[model samples]
Target chain A: MDYKTVLTTCTYCGCGCNMYLEVMDGRITGTIPCKTSPINEGKLCIKGWNVHEFVQSPKRLTRPMLRKNGDLTEVTWDEALDFTASRIKSIKEKHGNDSIAFLTSAKVTNEENFLLQKFARAAVGTNNIDHCARL
Target chain B: MIEEIKKQVRELLTSGTIKGFLGLREIDGHIAPYLFCDAEDMDSMNLGDYKKPGDARYPLNRILIHLLSHYPDEILGVLVRGCDQRGLNGLYSLNQLDPEKVIPVGIPCPPELAEACECSRPYPENRAVDGQAEGYSNQTLARIAGLDIGKRFEYWMNEFARCIKCYGCRDICPMCICRECSLECGDLVGKGDIPPENPIFHLIRAVHMADRCVDCGLCAEACPADIPLRTLYKKVADIVKKEFDFQAGYQPDAKSPLNVLDQ
Candidate 1:
């Protein structure tokens, strides 16, 4: 049994909390906060503590899904991205750019969030942008 | 001190006294709880001192509980500090661990760690280190306890308000070892409520810790919201001490009165 703790940053939020992913036999079984971390100082939120649950979760989506006939159907990444881009373009053309709102998550990195807002404002020409962390 | 503990653990493993030595090891530059089965690899044994003494402490007794279930007949050697020994005592009282099945090699907390933790007892019964630090005073507890009822209510409410509904405090607690927990009950604690229904979520835990909190301060340290949870649990311990004349974690032979149904 190869048991070890891999020190890494929590991917839940922008908090950048350091945690140790307790790997048992090469599978992440638990999460423990890194005590020496200056950022969180060994403290973690509900999300950070349960970070390992998502990696091997049976409910986790391994493939992209698209709604067809009122049901989410598994689709290829290309198909999903193409459908999303086409829909966004059609919506922006039919209605004004302000009609659609782009919402981002705290789970994404600061750089990613910045790019998303930049895309919404410049590419989509809409000021209707918000973040999940606002709540 | 690290060498001293290693020497003891190495002796135990070489002598065939213990099947495995449960302690912390610095593997891959990360200090974590580990079970060393051979004396030759005892070089990686650590006393949980990374940046400071006792900084990388884990619930070894809690891990020991899992170890005992798998290896009931085999004798295991475990590392223990003051808090760990207390945890072992609590486990013993609950029959979660058998004293005869385990050999605990303990070390005393440095003065800085004791002062930082405000640990009442800074060493196990059999201490490997001498002239350790004295336990510090309770300034936070004192300040909160000094407040009147109205102010106290407001103070705790503000602190509890910062709750992200994280179960880190409960999850990190060594005393929390029930198969089922009241905090997780859907009816008692509603689902999808952030910050978890005001004081009820925290109150349930406090009531449960009335006779079990070992004053480890891990709960407070683990809280992302920085809630002074240890103060609340410590108050429960104080109440148990004052009202019941009982303290948990000091003696393994003595069962907590709260756990005893007959009273």
Candidate 2:
């Protein structure tokens, strides 16, 4: 009996179509376009309609993975971040700042994208930045 | 007109006739479907701005179906335009709704809005607040019919090629109430292919709409690719009418011939 609709914005693209994620017993069951949303106006694209599919997908990554002996191994956040930082440092030292390019994703918030671009320019000193949406 | 509808809703709510009245409410200058449970909230209730039917129109019957599933025993009042009333009747025939437990407060589409929708009948039989308009001919179907066999095939293929596999048409359809959709069957529709095996994808949906489609035009409006889905479904409806002499959502008690074996 715990059926409720949580209004949220679609993260698939920059259009930011507002929709209601229909939750039944704490699980996302369906998506309904928000009729009052000025941006979408009750119309949703393909991605916005199926945005809930990835939430509880069995193939979704739950933990960080690091390659150990050519095989991906699950590791703690600290260990994974440390491994990433150390690898990036070594790669930049050998190949120069121009060699490393930063690829961002559309699934994250604009604030997260800003942080990624900032990290690329300030920390890594590389101007090569792009997004998955671009591809 | 708005005041009259609101007063009727308020009376229905205050008299304990229905637990809730489902209709559009203007919030922040945007009209959206809402369940007005309290009679006091009728002040903000709206019959929807029929002047701009495209923006104001919503699948109110779909929302009503959702609410009815949870509150099965409770009698509820719903605001129904012509298309919404047709959808409600379609749902009733399919056994998805109990007609007795629901009260329909019907409204008719203005002639301009009806002409825009190209709707056959823009007013419900009972409780209409406006006049009905003549149905407009679908030019797209006429154009398609004029083409030869090979050209017709090419025309449909070109249209189907633009499909992004969004399923928006199916999602917005009031008649598509199946728990398991055949379009998603991996065996029928090949996995991981966009534009989904050409005419097969669109044809399957058109066939499904044969006996069930109420021609609300929501599917066409919802499609991002601007596919002429309503025209295709209207053709299916025509076929059903020609072959079975049954029009969906026209009669409450009669069932679609496709659903019955001894029709």
Q: Pick the candidate with the highest TM-score.
A: 2
B103-168, model 2: which lDDT tens digit per residue? 999988777777777787777767735555566666667788899999988877888888889888
Docking class of 1: acceptable
Each model's DockQ score: 0.44, 0.41
- Please provide, for model 1 over A7-63, each residue's C-alpha lDDT reduced to its tens digit, 9 standing for 90 to 100: 889887777998888776567877888877788888888889999999898998889
Reference-based lDDT, residue B194, model 2: 81
User: Any runs in candidate 2 off by more than 4 Å, and if so which?
Assistant: A1-7, A23-28, A34-41, A55-101, B48-51, B128-130, B134-143, B147-150
Give me the candidate number with maximum DockQ: 1
lDDT of each: 0.85, 0.82
lDDT of 2 by residue, A1-135 (tens): 345557789988777898878675688867878766778777797788887888889998899998899999899999999988998999999999988999999889999999999999999999999999888
**Candidate 1 residue-wise lDDT, B43-159, digit = tens:** 988888888878888777776776677567988989988888888888888888899998999898888899888778888888765656677777778888899999999999999
Separate clash counts for every candidate? 1, 0
RMSD of each: 3.6, 3.3
Clashing residue pairs in candidate 2 are none
